[model samples]
Target: MSETSWITTPVTADILRGALELERTEHGVLPHRLPAWARAQSPDGQLAMAEAQPSGVRLVFRTRATAVELDTLRTRPAYPGIPPRADGVYDLLVDGRLFGRATGTGGNVLVLDTAAGTAETRPGPVGTVRFGGLPARVKDVEIWLPYNEITELVALRSNAPVESVPPGDRRVWVHHGSSISHGSNAASATTTWPALAASLGGAELVNLGLGGSALLDQFTARTIRGTAADLISLELGINLVNSDVMRLRAFTPAVHGFLDTIREGHPTTPLLVVSPLLCPIHEDTPGPGAADLSTGTLQFRATGDPAERAAGKLTLRVIRAELARIVEQRAADDPNLHHLDGRVLYGDADFAELPLPDGLHPDAATHERIGERFAKLAFGAGGPFAPR
Candidate 1:
């Protein structure tokens, strides 16, 4: 078919799901997990990059076109010594089922040097991903963007006119966490732990998993508070410890304040507080995690001494204990509030069976396990998010 024969549709907000805001950039429309106000408050580069990655964001519409093509400008990050990372994958879903997957040919590259604290962007051309041979009848279609790459929608074309679909009756689940929840090491966008769990639990996902930036920021908490959600979950501890942003004394009150702000907007919504998963490197040792490129492969290691606990340096174990205590104390008057130890999702037994590939993030298989466990624990019988 000729390119001119295809119907070109503007990528508007009506066909978008899971993004909190859409930015009209010079290149195209960029989806953002955090709203403009929140992004403005904290200009941290890591948070900006993560929120722009669109872990659970997707384009959803109803159409009868057998072929579709999407033009995108993707920005993938690169490091100094390590090999180039694989191109991000885009998943196509038809009638709520995975139909196919594709990768864009070329785009921009962002070279990040954490050791030197520098970043450089190299411009490139736009790339197109084409999907064809779909059933001709009317069906709901979703194009899930890559969870790990920054992407801007340049154009969307189809053989038939596409119309926006109405938001269904699924419960909206708002989730906040670190890179693991942001789809690190996950095979695709829809397979992220939160995304997989949302699918299994029959919930609409609004993923706010900002990698390396879940440091109990007030702006992030405020964003979550303002967003409408039927169920809310906050995954705390990993980022705080790895960043070594605060001590135990400050963390306790910060947690209280974050939750308090959310309660202002959602007085009785089911709120679940999740502590950090078991990371042996930071389980008992304090962080300021450091990169280990010793063996020509990227890995993480805790730098703070274990003896620093006496000085209030936080660790995964300490954070988990404190979080459980805080949740227990708060749940007395707030019946809708609950707590879950993330170890229950990926613990010692799990680690032994499926070790974290990078000594930090879970591998793709582990994501599947965590997603299954979360769906069963949070959405199953007698669970906090269980239907009333």
Candidate 2:
């Protein structure tokens, strides 16, 4: 498809309109905001875009560094002239073609002027600019970011006309997760494990893999609960582990709450909750938390201190076990709920083969491995995510 041909808004615009909800959540909206162009082509554009009106499916991509040092290095290796800024450069594609791109002048700096409510771009090491006003005309789109320059993609949006779409058997898969699921360190949006998995499984997708933003909040879960999807997966626990954001006592209930909210509307839909893959530091460790004395950022740290490690602080192994237990207990009453070990997607053995560059998030090869495993274990015939 031509990059510009992606403007098939008339067809996709309506499909998006039909799924909008009036209720709101921390993340806001049932359908969320249908891009103006996507809404303009529909019959109920006014309602679709009006107050409390549901909009389009939202795909958030977030990042949370397993190693605090990595978090400290965000957007570092500052491009020539740009004063290292968190924002990075990227390209967007739909299907197999280029759709749009975030422009970056190699030697430019981006200044975030919150007071002015606008960012100023000037010559520096690297510059970042967003590309919006997308067509929202198709069920699938691809996002490409400079792998060497940009470490991750934050989110994705679907503006397809959900309201007027011709009747068909197409089922949309709404996925939400952190940087790993968000296409971090991947060559392009299409190459992201989730995107690849969705394509390989033959399901349309709304990517909500927000980099550093998948904290399993009511808002995020509520957002997913209100949206429509045939399949939904929440790759929780990893971010929690890496961020050391909550204690063990709080982790279990948070997972339960997040899932409970999603279950409200998708009562019988296959819902998979995945625990974090193996990351040695948090695999069996605990935490009281460690402050990066250098930056005063309290990153998730494992107290190599044996006494502290034994205290049952929040750890990946602990979180994973707790999640499994919760799912097992809940599944007795909720048959649609399922649990999968993130290791099945990227295990310790797999890590030996393709160690994460930053010792936290998986590298490109690992992403490919994850995509394949997810496709087979989840999308294969008889699997929970398989089409009915």
- The top-ranked prediction according to lDDT is 1
Tens digits of per-residue lDDT, candidate 2, 178-285, equal 768766666554667886787678776666665555677666676678788899998886667555667767777888888888889889989988888877666766
Candidate number with greatest TM-score: 1
RMSD of model 1, in Å?
1.1
Roughly what TM-score does model 1 have, to 2 decimal places? 0.98
Q: Flag clash pairs in model 1.
A: none
TM-score of each: 0.98, 0.63
Point out the worst 10-residue segment of candidate 2 by lDDT. Answer: 65-74
Candidate 1: Cα lDDT at 233: 98
Candidate 1 stretches with Cα past 4 Å from truth are 1-4
